[model samples]
Target chain A: MTGKLTVVGLGPGSPQQVTPEALAAVAEATDFFGYGPYVDRLDLRPDQRRHASDNREEMSRAAAALTLAAAGGSVCVVSGGDPGVFAMAAAVCEAIEQGPDAWRGIEFAVVPGVTAMLAVAAKAGAPLGHDFCAISLSDNLKPWSVIETRLIAAAGAGFVMAFYNPVSKARPHQLPKAFEILRAHLPGTVPVIFGRAAGRPDEAIRVVPLSEARADMADMATCIIVGSAETRLIARDGNRPLVYSPRSWDAASAGKR
Target chain B: MTGKLTVVGLGPGSPQQVTPEALAAVAEATDFFGYGPYVDRLDLRPDQRRHASDNREEMSRAAAALTLAAAGGSVCVVSGGDPGVFAMAAAVCEAIEQGPDAWRGIEFAVVPGVTAMLAVAAKAGAPLGHDFCAISLSDNLKPWSVIETRLIAAAGAGFVMAFYNPVSKARPHQLPKAFEILRAHLPGTVPVIFGRAAGRPDEAIRVVPLSEARADMADMATCIIVGSAETRLIARDGNRPLVYSPRSWDAASAGKR
Candidate 1:
């Protein structure tokens, strides 16, 4: 094939945050493929072929993109966040590997984009200042038992957490259950920042005590940030509360300058 | 002051990854300030002023940069990874507040850059496919007790972890000690990927089981990735060892395509 394939990250929410490189990659592609919601973000011309489907069909979608590339069409496989982070980059690579003839001579490139974790962390004022981890509560691929064991281990290890896919339409209670598991080991006063659609229109970011986080407050797109015991919400003048996990502090230290 | 300030992220590693917009911001700046290593990445003209320091002194350096900006110097506060992620962005905002003069009149903007967590995660395949967290291990600002607690929480929560500052010259044993704490709660077979100076010359990325991650294997510049129970290293032909943390999977009965 004379064509190439480029996987582009559309960034966490807005087009403004999309890097110029990602924009160029998409603009240069003759065919664009991605999740349905992600494809909605682009304004395509009449000649460009746009293909999108539910996230569940990522493998097939990726395979289709490669097939198109193999036919000598430059294709862009786009993702909402950085393609490598819980996105379609690997799936595309896997698809390519599974079908030797699909994209035999097609060169592939994975472009990085801003991810939800960083966007939510920024919106929440650095709750990820120290060591933290991200976990998805969705059990579609793995059993809940395995997730529970990992949660217990993470909580005991005292890592801050960014929860992706904490809740979805079918599994509304997953977040509360996850929180209960965490509360069992962490202090009740530990902070939790819930960020919905971070960096997008109607973005909502709130800081609440771990004891106060409710199941109804989140959805598939929400990013839940649960802080360790040392994380604190520092209130600044007339600004959003800044959440930060202290990395270090001298007991004899002076106040903020 | 007639000057402006722009805070930019150089992205994780590699000059090729640096976005053109970020480069433009740097090119236009009369004074460049950032962590010592990041500032060294750019080729500078003789007239360009550079300010560099260790990561711990980010706040101090930011404060100094703000002072310079207030005195009419167009300053570019640069960071290796995205400036907003555990970098100098917050410090710049805080310093602006602490300055003798309000910087509200100064044109200030933050340019997004690639982050180490994303870069390392890409290189290792997809260890962060599910939920993950990024935390710095430097206790220079917080107590080790806090770090220990967060580590436990993250581990207990089943969140993959990207550890920054795994070790340092003065604190060579912290990484191993952290590993011990994690091992106490997690299975010894859990995988840990150590990325040293990722994207830079002499970059090294190694995947080892938790039981084999020794203190001597890491240092301050290393970004350590510890996988959740679901994470596994899959051998791929000619493409290096790939790490995959499956988020969802079809029934084994479906058969691998």
Candidate 2:
């Protein structure tokens, strides 16, 4: 059989959140390539091989997966959340673009899954109900300046912000800086949600106002969502407050602008 | 029995894209409620009732669903993509916020699924792999000026844009206008992807440069992704070209800025 490569998302560490399409891709592949924890999520038959690596080794993992597929073995690259959202799909595409000419011919497909932000938003009421943006705070790839610029613009444009890779041991201060920038652009009353390991057994979801949002609230496993100026927090007795941005912004304000 | 309300996403019209969690919710629900087409997507047993409503009647539909759940029925409100993203989740939240006090006691949950933009980006080789924003061009709820402001801010900040509700019968000219505004802020070389009914049998994915992108290329079912300045396109023989925004941005430029 001709070598084929498929990248699929396991979805926020939940077996229930994984789609049939992603599962189908996983079952058909002869080999799996991904970060250790993500790869461990898969239930593989003895005939299938697993190539697990460290989290930061995206480029190398993509190259290795491509090489395996080029050698006529079916390969599956697994990612946590949707493969297209700051994940393996782009890494594989990048590898194919710059790699050997033969690598371009390999059949490839990406099976989308419930990304972390969406899952996180669901756990809350619907902070992402209106316009929103997803930005990864990992400076390992992009500059911190770019992240700052995007955050300001997203807040200025009244788009809800969903942040991935909010904090890590290597980058302890960026999330704080991000919160500071957002506070300047948005009202202090806007809600900030830190969803850790959402959809997983240890999932913890917290909501705080922008004024009280702290860097310590987030870790690498967290996906943080900062509400736009229009985002609302509804009080619910004996339960977590529901947060949602109304579908309609101030129509009167739009007229004035 | 206690009342429960679960909002679930059907995932861009593909049965394969729906998650096990969503399916389980559908199986357990005593009634389904949503827009006509979305409600039609569910395979209901005779005992399971469906309350299909017009697409524009979101508030009423949400109220009706909440009323059912409040009356001790297991209710599931379905949306085409992820319910939290520009879908029914917010509408339900809004209804609960403004409706009867008794509505607060209902158990509520949202099951996230593959959103249209993610499905579209996957088809186009991860155009959203980098920082990105999702906007709706529809002016039915918000003013067009708000959409325009967001377009300019997103483009100026170098964020990829995924547009939902790009064109509809009532709003034919908005998308063309949106393209014009985007063209002003973004380079003409940026790639625009028109993914209609993504992940479904009738899915059609098209890629075009910014200068050549037109309103006719998209419809209401389409999710249009506009790449950032750094987005790349890779060509292949006998296949559609791959489009992806790299994870890394220009670090040198960031330092200068």
Candidate 3:
């Protein structure tokens, strides 16, 4: 069969952020499957069918996409950022593992896109230029204890961290505990960035010290960046300050020009 | 001043991967600054000027881009992948921190792109569908000791890791040491992926057990992914195997079928 299932990441927000590969996939696919918001973002044509489902139903959505592809249809599974990063790519593979053996014969491909944390890092200076980790703080899939252990290990190891799902109405207290864990291992002077709705028109990026980081500063739309020891702030004469980590770590880096 | 310093990531090696935002920035730029190879990739017009330099001279290249922007020329500093990921965004911000005070007054924005690690992860199924970290193994900027420590910590914390610059001729032994460190914590069966020249025509991806991973498997063009303890492999029916990590975890997840 010529049927195929291609997973595409449309990127965070702006239309300009969508790559030509994603656009081309949308054009070629007979069906698009994804969360409601991402499916709504696709440029739908009369010939294209869309299966927009709730955000939490990733497995079911992936199974449906696979079913269509196995029946000789070109399907595209869309994600907000890159499909591989805590997104539908895993779900699609999981579906293949659990579904009918015939589904495994279908062709599958993943198309990457700009993830939110990188976009947030760009908006706020380059706090992630050094050794870094990305962790989702929500305990929806895993235990909160795992998140805590990862946080302490990440902080103690001096890795800059970009936190996704830092705060949500369902899991509000996790960010505060995370900050406390990091603060215990890191200095209070470490730079922390709260980027809300990055790449969107109302995007707001706030840079603060770890000591000043409050749980209230984050939400589901926010991504937090807690910098390593080398993260620095450049105070401009009459402009907003820029936060960045130098490329090199040496004695010379400690002294400013 | 009409000058603006826009740092854009070219998104690995594919034209289709380049976002419209990066293309727009390049089109509007009067002066393009980057490594010789990346600059050659751009479709430069006669009215536009190009300043390509060696890969190691990031600081000077960034200073030049800022200097041109400060002098009323639209400048674009290019990185092969996402600028925020061990690339020119930090260097451009570093140049601003150390350059003339006038350079600080120039407007600068970082446009994100599809980074190499994400592209690699996409090619190798969804190995990074869980919490992960990215660490650059080149000791050019940071010490090997730092790399060793981070590797141990990341492994102990059970983070799937993407290693960039895993094996350069100058740093041949580092990847082996990294594998040794990870082997102490993870199983020998943990799947490791080496994605060489991802998104390019010469692209190749290799998946092997951690026990079998060799330093020669990687080069400067390779991006490596060392999966967590939970990573899995699915044997295809007369096809290549698929590597992916499931979205679920814990005792409760086992009964989902």
Candidate 4:
């Protein structure tokens, strides 16, 4: 009963972004487990078995996949973005570490996919071109105060930030609070990207200055990009402004060398 | 004579990691421009013109791609990893913003690829499973002091850190300096991964503790992944130990909300 388990990232929302490695894992799998929407993207055949479940069931879902794999069924665990980033990879590892010793026998691997942050960064030009920090604003696993602290630390450290799961029904006010902290530490002209549904057909990217950004602009499907102090918004002719942070950094009067 | 310019990420190394969109862009392009090593990856036909140049000439290479595109040629500007992340996308945008305004008239798009940090994270079993920061240690564009500041801030914030261009012939001591800074704030047992040539035929991944990490362990082709305080190293059966950061953050004692 040595079945293999592979956690795969399905990219953002476009099939065009799916890598051959991830595609191969799905094609070779006997069973699949994922959130309903992401599992639906696989379009499985009648022979392919699937276990569609609710979101935030990461640990349970990983345990289930391991249990299946331990019983001689190859499983493909899927996530919307890169499995390694706020997705199933860590959950599965946690499951394997804390579960019965038999769970360790299952061969496990994670195939990285094109994460939404990268897709969103590309769609909104190169706001993440330089140093950056990625934080998931969903406080389901941690406290809201921790999220606020990270946001402030990231802002004060001058990191262009990519915020995932910025706003959900349960976590509505956190995004605004985050923005307030950013306004205190960052310039008002910093470009803020409300990248909703990136890489999808109906993708919409709204770039606003920090002074004009609002909480209503983001939802669960959005990836909010807050550029660093050095980030620039370059205006183009009859096109949306391009956002980016040049590679260079200015650090003249700093702390001790 | 309108032309289109697309910046494409070639993924880490394997052709299998490339997305269909990036391949489509390459197939449709008449000219390619990139660093010598990355350009060598694109085995194009005689009809496809290539402009391979020395490394660190990102701006010039981007200007060349834009110039070719402005003259009615479809061009694909290639980067080894995701182009928008410390790669050619920002350079191209900078050129468009600073170069002749005519370059902006050309249609521009960025097709994201699997960056090395993600690939490295996958290989290491999701060390970046939680919040993380990516800092490029190359001081060519930024001051060395800024890199030190980022290292300290990332460590203090408990964010797993990914270092790009951590070492080179010219910048030999920065990686060691970085380790010194990280050692001050982090425990000695923290995992450090020297992911050299990820996804390539000669890929080598070394998972060591902060106490054992040395500057010479990394090179230009390496991406250094340093785990956070919460990261764990799980022992495997007849395999290298897996490293991952749990999804949950211990924030019971955070500051005021």
lDDT by residue for model 1 (A1-257), tens: 35888888888777656776687787888789999889989888888888988878888998889888888889998888788787887777566556775353576667778778777776665566555666767887667876787677666555677787788888877788898988887877788888877767888988888888887888788878888766666555555656766544434321210
DockQ of candidate 2 relative to the true structure: 0.88
Q: What is the DockQ ranking, best to worst?
A: 2, 4, 3, 1
Q: What share of the true interface contacts does candidate 4 keep?
A: 0.87
Q: lDDT winner among the candidates?
A: 2
Clashing pairs in 3: none
- Across A1-257, the per-residue lDDT of candidate 2 in tens digits comes to 44999999889888899999998999899999999999999999999999999999999999999999999989999999999999999999999999998888899999998999999999999999999999999899887877888988898788999999999999999999999998888878889999988888899999999999999988898999999888888887799999998888876433321
The numbered model that scores best in DockQ is 2
User: With candidate 3 superimposed using the best TM-score fit, by how many Å does residue B26's alpha carbon deviate from the native?
Assistant: 0.2
Q: Stretches of candidate 2 above 4 Å error? A: A251-257, B251-257
Would you list the C-alpha lDDT of every candidate in the order shown?
Answer: 0.74, 0.91, 0.87, 0.89
What is each candidate's DockQ, to 2 decimals? 0.34, 0.88, 0.80, 0.83
lDDT of 3 at B216: 88
Q: Is candidate 2 or candidate 3 better by lDDT?
A: 2
Q: Model 3: iRMSD? A: 1.2
> Using lDDT as the measure, what is the rank order of every candidate, best first?
2, 4, 3, 1
Better candidate number, 3 or 4, judged by DockQ:
4
Model 1: lDDT of residue A209: 87
Chain A vs. true chain A, TM-score per candidate? 0.91, 0.96, 0.94, 0.96
Docking quality level of the chain pair in candidate 4: high
